[model samples]
Target chain A: MSARDTILARVRDAALARPEAATNREAQVAERMTVGPKGIIPHQGQATGPQKLRQFLEKLEANDTTVTRVSSEDEIAHAVARELRKRNLPAAIRMGEDPMFHAQDWGSLDVSRGPGRLEEPVTLSRAQFAIAETGTLVLTSGPDNPVTLTFLGETHFVVLRTEDLRSGFEDMWGDFRKRGLDPRTVNMVSGPSRSADIGQVLQLGAHGPVALHLFMVG
Target chain B: MSGHVPTSSAFKSNSQEALVNRNLQAALRGSRGNFIAKRAAARANVPEFDDIRDQARDMKNHVLANLDLYLEAYEKKVTEAGGHVHWAETAEDARRIVLDICRKSNAKTVNKGKTMISEECGINDHLAENGIKPVETDLGEYIIQLRGEIPSHIIAPAVHVTVPEIEEAFRKHHAHLPPDRDLSELASLQAEARSELRAKYFEAEVGITGANMLIAETGQSVIVTNEGNGDLSQSLPKVHIVMASLEKIVPTLEDSATLLRLLARSATGQEMSVYTTFSSGPKRSEDPDGPEEYHVVLLDNGRSNMIGTEFEEMLRCIRCGACMNHCPVYQSVGGHAYGWVYPGPMGAVLTPSLIGVEEGGQLPNASTFCGRCEAVCPMRIPLPKMMRSWREREFEKNLTPSATRYGLGVWAWAAQRPWAYRLAARIANRSLGITGKSKFSKLPLAGGWTKFRDFPAPQGGTFMDQWKAGKR
Candidate 1:
């Protein structure tokens, strides 16, 4: 027998070993796969709009991710430029072909549309959704928003709309399903890359972006 | 060289050596309350932490109860997503399957993420013996790999290596670099490691990682990392092989989310890890970057027999390392003393289950039954109870030492007869009350206890006798 058959058979045996055999195992599993049950949603992430935006900013700061709120989408480019200048980084950024990003006036900033490169000083991606519960940025992989840019950039700049901010994973996943884009990867990034491997001292920028600056288009 | 062979049978001696090893003791002391305090603060910050833990436990239990069915569904989804799943009954099977994949991919060097599953299967040594270089990407794992030692701690693999010791290892290994380079700061050390690993990540042909959660709903393997090395490891290689066991499966994305809420907080006190990447399969046809081939090796290595047995609860482990963090014995002696792939209270119960009661029995015996492990366990695994079960099994098998068994026999016999118990208790108390004076500095047949501190004498009599006398 194949290893799969052998292992599955043993699992079946073990489940049946009990006095009350696990009946309807396949049916129950099928039902669960189709109708995925929603477990307890944390009350912490139940707020909406301004209330959630405040919570989201607080949580994002707690993770060392800086956020700048812009009153309109047109200000996103200026905010990104300002952040880059403040950090003394090059005025160059890479991004994908997201129409939301293209609609902005870049104002002579060097912007490339493709995947990430090794020396990319800064890369921008529009967050599909932001979770208020943990201040996580959810980015999907595609031509419009390549996932490599999320990890490859030395300093990552993300554009999130206040309206797209979610309270928790359950709500965010619901939105994802409605959007109906099945990207290869769904990255839920919370903060700058860090490691406590050496003497348990928390050090940032251990392989991913050292700084994650969020441009919140409120 | 091969992987470190199991020295679990000599755990007694190993712990004894660990207690006095100055460097190990210093490292343990430095990190003693860090995890405990962080977990406490994280728990306090979340109002619904316990509720989430409960939901997570229920989800895991539900999946385990119907593992066969879920595995089937998971396989179907993975196949639909253009991925392959290989089933391995033992460590050898896993190693063979992985080797076959690497050979097919023509891999010379493979970058690795931190995966306890690979350690359990001894994948690194197997790959090396077969002429493939396995580069550990996680900083802690890399440090320990350089030292040629098993991880002293799970999450913090090089926790036992002091800062100076790390410097020594780096200097000795990276001799090609400038010898006089300033390695004084932790920042400098991190930069060096980052630069070294960045080059290797791009050069590797295959990247192997361990899955934190396997979602049967979408055929996705989720990995949670703070360092982001797991992402690079999987993303850069031509073939990405996820080393996971059958029990890592969760029913849906929602189920994974519930567990994720508990995971980072319980392990590292983070609201969420920096990177929680969910990779379903290889890159899409239009994707700019990602691996082309995706394979998941589903290892069973004795987990199958654990189902429906008393020890089945061990399968719920998510490899969070929280149990070891909160384990008092572990904090004192450290992880290497457990003498195997796993250590601490979780290891105490799990080691025996995975590798029989003979070689791994001493691990369960090492526990103090403080119940701290179970208290801090996110999945609510009753660790102390299972350790007690192992002790019982050891006794039934006559694997327990004769002295302990005889002593327990005497105590049990005396307790069964109230009159005899009281008579003996009174005699012992009177003798100790008179001879001990304030406390017994020395005692027959208890040098182990008296060597560290004096044993306090009984005040008057046993608690039962005192209670009866007070009533009268």
Candidate 2:
């Protein structure tokens, strides 16, 4: 027999040996997958409106992620340039074919559109949704937001509109499914990459961006 | 290192050596309270932490009872999403499956994310023996790999290596760099490793990572990591192979959130890990970059047998490492003393189950039964109860040491008769009282107990005698 069959048979035998096994487990599993029961949502995950946005900003700061709220979409390029100048990073930035990015006119910043290369100093991507409870950004993989730019850049800049922010994982995922989006990967980033592997001291930027800045647009 | 021989039978000696090893003790002491304090602070911030843990435990129990159905469902979803699922009944089978994928991909170098399942399967050794270089991308795993050692701790693999030892390993292995460079500060060492490994990330043909959860609803394998290496390892390689146990499956995305809520908080005291990547399959045709082929290897190396047994609750573990972090016995002896891939309270119950009671029987005796592990376990697994069960099984199988069996036999014999038990206790108490010393630095039959510290001498008479006298 194939390994899969043998293993499944063993699991089935053990499961059926129990006295409670009289119930139809197959039906139970199917129902669970279809119904998708929402478990206990923390009180903090249920906040809304300006309170949720405030909570998200507080969480972002707590996790060491810098955030700048721009009053309009046109101001994002200027915000990005200011952050780069503040950090003394290169003036160049790599991004994808997102139309939001295309709409903005980068004034003096060296902006290029493509997938991330080996030595990308700065990269930008648009997050589809943001979770207020944990300050997580949900980015799906596609030409609009290439996944490599998320991990390859020395410093990463993410753009998320205030309207796109959800209270928690449940609402964020709810909005994600409503959009009928199916990307290869769903990257939920809370903060910049970090590691405490060396001497158990936490250090930022381990194989990913050292600094992660958010351009929150209204 | 292709196949690690189990030294668990010699756990007594291994722990003895670990207690006095200066370098190991320094490393263990340095990291002793760090995880505990962090988890405490994280739990303090979450008012509903314990409530969520209960929910997480129940969700896993539901999945376990219907594991066969869930596995089938998860398999179908993966196949539909243009991914392959391979089931391995044993570790050898898992190794063969992973190697076959690497060979087909013509992989010369394979980058690995931090996956304890890969460590359990000994994937790195198998790959190297077949001439495929496997690079560990996690900072901790990379340091241990450089020293040619298996992970001492699951989350912190190099928890047993001191800073100087790491510098020495880097200098010896990375001989290409100038030998005279200053390596005094911690940041400099981290910067050096970062630059060295950044180049290797783009060189691998296959990337292997372990999954924290496998959502049966969406056919996604999720990896929760603080470092983004797991993401880069999978995204940059041409083929991505996820090594996960069958027990990693959850019924839906919401169920995964329940586990996620507790996982990072329990492990490292973070509200959320830096990155939690939920990957479904290979890259979409319209995508700019990602692995072209994705495979999930479902390994059931002894987990299938764990069901319907006394150790079934162990399968509920999310690999959070909290049970070990809060374990006093584990804190003192460190992870290596357990003499296997897993350590501490969980390993005490799991080792014998996976490797058999004869070879791994000694581990259950290493615990003090303080109940701290059970108290902090996010799954609320009865770890101490399971260890007691293992001890019973060991005694029944005659795997226990002869001296321990003889001692237990004597205690049981006297306890069965009240008169003999009282008489023996009185005699022993009188003899100890007659010593006139407050404590004994040496004893006739208790050299093991007295070897470490002095044994206090009994005062006056036995408890039975004292109770009768008080009544008079």
Candidate 3:
């Protein structure tokens, strides 16, 4: 027999050996997949309004992700430029063909549209959703926001509108399904990449971005 | 560098060496309280942390009971999403499957993310023997790879190596760099590794990573990592291979969410790992860049047999490393003492189950039954109970040492008879009291215990005699 069949048979046999497994397990699994029951949602995940926003900002800061709230969408380019200048990074930035970015006129910054390169000093992407529960940004892999930019940049800049922020994974996933979006990869990023491997001391910017700045638009 | 041979039978000697290895002790001391304190703070921040753990444990139990159905569902979704799933009944089968895919891709170099399943299968050795160089991208894994050693600790693979040792490894392996470059600071070392590995990321043909969870609903293999190497490894390579065990299956993304809520907090005390990527199949046709071919290798070396046995709860493990971080014995001996891919309390229960009671029996005996492992376990696996069960199996199978077996036999015989037990206890109490000192600097038949510290002398009559005399 093929390995798949043999392994499955053994698993089936072992599972059926139990008295409890004699119940209709196939139906139970099907129901679980279809119903998709949510488990105990932490009280922190149930925040709303100003409290949620406060929690989100606090979490972002706690995770070492800097954030700046811009009053309007048009101000994003300026904010990006300001951050780039403040950090002394180059005026160039790599990104994908997201219409939201294309609409904005990048005044003096070098904005290139494509996937990430081997050496990306700065890269920008628009987060589809932000979870306030853990200060996580949800980005889907596509031409709009190429996934490489999320991991290849020395410094990553993500744009998220305040309205796109959800309370937690439950709401975020709800909106994700409602949009009927099916990307090859869904990347949830909480903060800058880090590792505590060397001497068990936490250090940021292991392989991804050394610094992650959020341009939160309201 | 073939598959790691289990040295678990020599756990006593391995732990003996580990306890005196000053370098290992220093490294362990540095990392000892960090994880414990951070986990405590993370738990305190979430009022419903324990409740979520309970829910996670129940969900995993349900999944394990119906594992066959879930695997079928998960496979179907992967196939629909343009991904291939290969089932391997043994580690050798898994190695062969991974090699076939790599050979098909003509991979000369393979980049890897931190996958303990891959380690268990000895994928790197298999690839290297086949003329393919496998590069470990995770910093800790990379350090151990450089040292020609397996991972000691699961999360922190090089936790047994001191900083000076790391400097030496980097200096020896990275001879291409300037000899007198600044290697003193931690940041410099991290920067050097980043630059060194950044180039290799783009050169590999196949990228292999371990899956934290394989969602049956979406057929997406999820990876939770602090470093983004796993993402780059999968995204940049032409072929992405995910090595996960059969037990990694979860019913849906919602179930994965519940596990995720418990995973990072338990492992590293983060609310969420920096990157939690859910990758389904090959890249979408419209995507700019990603692996063109995706394969998931579901391994079941011994997990299938564990499903209906006393060790069934072992399958609920999420590889969080919390049990080890909180285990006192594990803290003292370090991970290498377990002499296997897994270590500490969870490993104590699981090693025997996976490798058999004969070869891996000594690990279950290494515990002090402190119950801290189960207390901190997000899955709440009865680790001490399972260890005790293994000890029983070992004794039954005659795998335990002769001396231990004889002692146990005497204890059992005495325990079954109230008169003999009382007589023996009274005699032992009186004999110890006859020492006339508060403690014995040396004791007969207990040299091992006395070698470390003094044995306290019995001060009074036996508990039975004291109770009879109304001393309670």
Candidate 4:
């Protein structure tokens, strides 16, 4: 017999040794997977309105991610430019084919649209949603938001909209399901890369971006 | 590379050597209270931490009770997502399957993220034997790989290596750089490794990573990392192979989220790790970049036997390293003393089950039964209880030391008869009280105990005599 079969049979016998009534195990699993019960959503992640936005920024900064707020989408380009200027980086950035970013007037900035390449100084990607609980940014993989740009940039700059922020993973999953979108990859990035491997001292920017700057626009 | 034989039976000798090694002692001392303090502060920061832990444990129990069904569901979803799953009954099978994939992909070099399963299977040695280079990209794993040694700790692989040793290794291996370069600060060493590994990431043909949690809902393998090496490892190479044990599967994404909430806090005291990437399958056609082929090797070396047994709760372990972090015995000896891929309380129970009791029995007996491991375990697993079970199994198999068995036999026989037990206890106590002279630097039968510390003399008569005199 195949390893899969033999192993599964062993699991079945061992798991059912006491015989807890085999009541259509497949159906039970199917139902649970479909419904996906939410287990113990933290009270910290269940706020709304300005309170939610404030919690999101606090948690984001606590994780070593800096955030800047713009009153309108029109100010996103200027904010991005200002971040680059403050860090003394060149006026160059890479991004994906997301229409949200293309609509912005990137005045005097050199912006390239595609996946990430080696030695990308700075890259911009519009976050699909920001989770308030852990201050996580959910970026889906597609031509619109190439996943490579998320990890390849030396300094990653993300544009998040205040309206797109959710309280927890449950609401974010709801947004994903309602949109009927299934990307090959969903990256939940909390901050810039870091490692404590060298004598257990945390050094930022191990393999991914060293500096992660966020522009929260409304 | 040093040939790593299972020296588990020599745990006593290994621990003694570890205690005396100056470099190892310094390294272990530097990191002794950092994890404990961080975990305590992280837990204190969250009000509902214990509630979440309970929920996580219940979810795992539900999945384990229906493991066959969950595995079937997880396999179906992976196939639906355009990925292939391979089941391996043993470590050899896992290595063979990975090698076959590498051959078919014509992989010359493979980049690897930090995966304890790979360490368990000895994949690097096997791959190198087949003439394929496996580059460990995680900073800790990379350092240990260069030294040709297994990881001392599961999460912190090179926790036993000191700073000077790392600098020396980097200097010897990276000889292409200028010899006079300054490598004094820790930052400089980190910078050198970062730049060195960057080139290898783009050149490798295959990338291998381990899964923290595998969701049966979407057929996704999720990995969490503080550094972005796991992301780079999976995204850069043309083929991505995930080495996972079958017990990693969970019923749904919500279940995964619950466990994720507790995992990082318990492991490193972080609200969330820097990167938590969920790779469902190979890149979609419309996607710009990702691995073209994705394969998952679901390894079940001895996990199948663990299920539905006294050791079944061991599967609930999430490899958080909390048990070892708070373990006094582990804190003293460090991880290498366990003489296996795993260490500490978890390893004491698991090593005996994975490797046979005869070979791994000494590990179970190494514990102090202080119950700190079970107290800090997020999964609420009875780690001390399981280790005791392994000792029982050893005694039943007659693999225990003959002297210990004889002593236990005498104690048991005397205890069954109350009169003989009282008489023997009084005589022994009185004789010891007279001869001990307050403390014993040496003892007749307890050389092991006396060799480390002194044994105190008995105060007076036995408990029965004192009770009869109204002392009770």
Candidate 5:
């Protein structure tokens, strides 16, 4: 016995072949199974830099978010048009068109373009700062770039630059093999835009972007 | 025009009012922030990704302990490569063997290429309730099949619709003849969904896919894509089925290139996902854009009762939404709030054992045991000890919650007395800190743990009042 106890004795013989249809919450989750545990939640080993992952996305947006650093991708696209004009919202900026991110410094970053359709909410700049250990992003997809202007937006304003982060995923896959880069798609969005399909109900911009506004520059 | 919206047989008739619905908490809040940061960026990119998830769970329990001698060496390498290997064992004998091979290859129309076992055999509402048009030619499932909806995200299936609701679902499903369009033109919504799905890929006689790894030394299947629509739904079809399920086999092209370098870096943090292919069968004899006829069905549906079981390390899942991208309850409830067709933490433990833990067991009590989906499961599938064995089969079948069976039956009878559970948590923490003015929001029958969130207030003293005020 064991391919975990024959997958929990075939879920306790299909919850004892259905006793008033199984729920004494799935025969107490069929006598509480456990087999080899540990999965993930460690990365707080620290390494956020794009000015501490843009002051932890402006102190999780609007919370004493302090940061003092600037180098340029056009001054992090004028600090993302001054944080989407405090919050009036409407911008479509899209430029990676590649020259190895315009061969560094002011690579281009006024992102606003959006729509890969999970119900529509836009934000599309793939870099300025990336690597909170490995939520990794530093996109470059080219042809004056139109990969849904960085995955059809719903609040996806990335711009990272604490000397472009990278401590993991083989240190930004050795900067995509020392800058040949454009193998076309690179969308490392860390949060927001979600779905559990309807019965597990926990929806947010369903197909993409419910929130992920980063802006780190150094 | 069967635009694919079907999954409602309601999980097949009320899997408990579709797991207590309020639009499944808006599809579990867009599947809890991309499976909690894609299993915290695949557990900071392999710190021996939990000992390479126990050697890919002993290579999927050594290919499900020799599943019929690796399905007769994957049907003798798909009939020595000309291809055509079928086997159903149910979803009505794999939709009556793909509607008798699309009515003996006459097939009116079909394009699809994102086959989660043709969304667990509902097969575009059984080939559009049998009339047959079936399109979903994947571009986030052709904008959630032109806004009819479902498939909210599993390697990005319209990850919860946004972009001015995909520019009002392409101005209400692209109402012909443009008018100042340019919603960042996306090649004019990919040339009006390729002139309405390039006539179902050249009046398709048949083309349907969904393999993402199958091999067993040679019967090849693999599919990882960025859109060459699984190679134009298997080289502009004359018939190509494929479906898949028996824990998507493995055993060589160097064990599926070590599961395709851990499947496009635990899916979409990317090292390679722009079309991965590896087809190997129908199109040989000096090929030239293949498929004159190639079948491959394979289903098992319940996966041979998870071959030996602790829920068979959820058949070493490679779905890699990295446990609903790092579940904080699949990021505030998403994937149609886990009603079924497998959503987050591998559909809360394979939909209470494939649609039945009393018909979709309260999806392993939604969850907060939060071990960030067994630290990013490249195949490490522990998932908070399988959501505490579905809360120990919902507390040994009394289906719990009579105020959680009177609060875990008076905290398991004052947890077998540590001085009557520390004098009933020190007189319920000094009557909830003198009627919670120290604020835990509000309590009593713990208003379902302070409604949506915020439940802090206990530090005024305890771990036995900070261990007897730090050892007196």
Candidate 6:
């Protein structure tokens, strides 16, 4: 065996020799109650991730969540205001001193795009996505947008293009490395913020979002 | 969560009652369900979970083996990066080092993230006693701290506490609020905490947080949390202190990534937490944000003793609270009944090492030899065997009671003479068969089993006797 295998073997041998821990093992199986996760809609055939995301946004719009296609952050600002009012959750989008976020006029939206204020929900601009095979959103922190945006809101709406959903984390990080973008913090949003902290009872919107609407536009 | 941990004398007398409390059954059932399912879901998604854990464990162990070299290298790198590294041999030294730094900076108050080492050292109590109020910035920790209670769980400190209790605590503490409102609004309570913590964050002078992993290659620290308090604690203060065990060092960023991937999934089953941050030294020259002064306090309360022993693998612990989550005893008692800061199976094994078993003895015997803890441990710390070793340590030191020694010694003496032992087992089983009826209605001996109910009587005949009779 090579040195890697040799070290691993030693560790494995050490572990197997350990005395078995005996806790209450009295179990008669119960059937697990879960519906297999709802598979995302439609097919892209041979198209890239962008095509799949475009299809996903169409699905969301079909489910009453709309999308606003944009070339710049200005349209994103407008879309966010429209979506928040539609969902009955107020918008408190904050803007920072970064030239990228501040360049957008924010279009009469109830906004504050800097450091998030306490007790108010916010929809700050996102840089990009590391979309999963499933529709998971990956947002990282840099000079433009920090880590707080993803956490502080009761409702989070990310406006990324369909083409932005790369293959997976490994694929995205590889691309990030190639671009020399030393990403410090990368956050992935699946559904909404959730917690079971109290009595194993499922309570959504524990600390963050209860409703997450993805407004993906091409 | 006790008004305070009862004095050792009081605790020794009341341990039985503490374990048999009215709420014990409820707490155990609630805790056992959550962690078991969490681990199941986590493992289901990542079938390579065990392999990932193994790689991460070895990575940590390899770093520790060359710890002196890496530590010296880290110090050099830290100084090069304009950060300060302090070595604390003892809790008092760690405290004094932090206190002196706080004093130098003219700090009146400090906002703190949950650091078990700091908790182990009772830093908050020490700081508070010296009139420097240290506020716990994490929401769960902050709530428990305000209530003047010890954390009942490692990751979720206030896990055992109900919403109503929290509501009452808030009602009493949130003095400026209207007292007669419906308390169903949890977001408002969270908002209240945020606003309260927000003021402390802005007003506090020094901030202290724990590093989940310390990257040796870059001389940096990483903390992963959803509440976003670690960042605030590190950034808002003029001086930021990262208190971490010497065991928390990883070799490289790539290694840190592998561990981070395992951590959140193993912990709360998140793909990655909302915040997985890295802070190296103080603010850079071009950077306008971050702490002006960064200090890393490397603590080894008694960890070095494990570096080259059967228990050396215990140092590979990542503090993910996975083992504790699945710990049956911890689930039953919650953390407070363990009577030390570290609770669960990991604590049962680790506490004895740090605080002399002589001071906090009997903790090692608290488990029922349940293997779930070892099964779920990412590092695969041989918790039961280590705990048994600790019990052996107690026995060797004569810390066990005289009655236990006499009884066990008599049993051993009888067992050596197989015929006599067999005869005794036959008699005992017969008697149990009579008096026990269906089961042992009342057990005369055995402290743990009898305290709740009777142990089931053994089968009527000895195995040897039954075998011989059947052969005939």
Best by DockQ: 3
Backbone clashes, candidate 2 = 0
- Cand. 6 Cα-lDDT: 0.66
lDDT string, candidate 2, B1-472, tens digits: 5656788899999999999999999998899999999999989888998999899888898889989999999999999999999999988999999999999999999999999989888899999999999999999999999998888877888989999999999999899999999999888888888899999989999999999999998899999998899999999999999999999999888888888889999999999999999999899999989999999999999999999998999999988899889888888888888888998888888889888999899999988999988998999899999999999999999888798899999999999999999999988888988979999999999998899999999987788888889944
Worst 10 residues of 3 chain B by lDDT: B349-358
Model 1 accuracy (lDDT, Cα): 0.89
> Which ten residues in a row are the worst by lDDT in model 5 chain B?
B1-10
Cα lDDT tens digits for candidate 6, B400-445: 8998899889999998999889899888778877764666545667
- Tens digit per residue, CA lDDT, model 5, B312-418: 67877878576676666555545665654667778778877665566456667777676767776777778779767866886687665576778788888889879
Give the lowest summed-lDDT range of ten residues in model 2 chain B. B1-10
Candidates 4 and 5, the one with greater TM-score? 4
Winner on DockQ between 1 and 5 is 1
- Judging by lDDT against the true structure, name the best candidate: 3
Worst 10 residues of 3 chain A by lDDT: A30-39
lDDT of 6 at B263: 78
Q: Tens digit of lDDT per residue, candidate 1, span A44-131?
A: 7687877888899889999999988899998888988999999999989999999989898998899899987666789999889999
lDDT (CA) per prediction: 0.89, 0.91, 0.92, 0.90, 0.58, 0.66
Error of 6 at B168 (Å): 1.9
Candidate 5's residue-wise lDDT over A46-158, tens digit each?
34555446434432333111233566555665666666666566544444344434544432434322223322344444452354442444454334333333434446565
Q: Considering only chain B, what TM-score does candidate 1 achieve?
A: 0.97
Q: Which portion of correct inter-chain contacts appears in model 4?
A: 0.78
Model 6: which docking level applies? incorrect
Top-down lDDT ranking: 3, 2, 4, 1, 6, 5
Q: Residue B262 of candidate 2: its Cα lDDT?
A: 91
What's the lDDT for residue A146 in model 1? 87
> iRMS value of model 5?
20.6
Candidate 4 chain A minimal-lDDT segment of 10 residues:
A29-38
TM-score of 5: 0.31
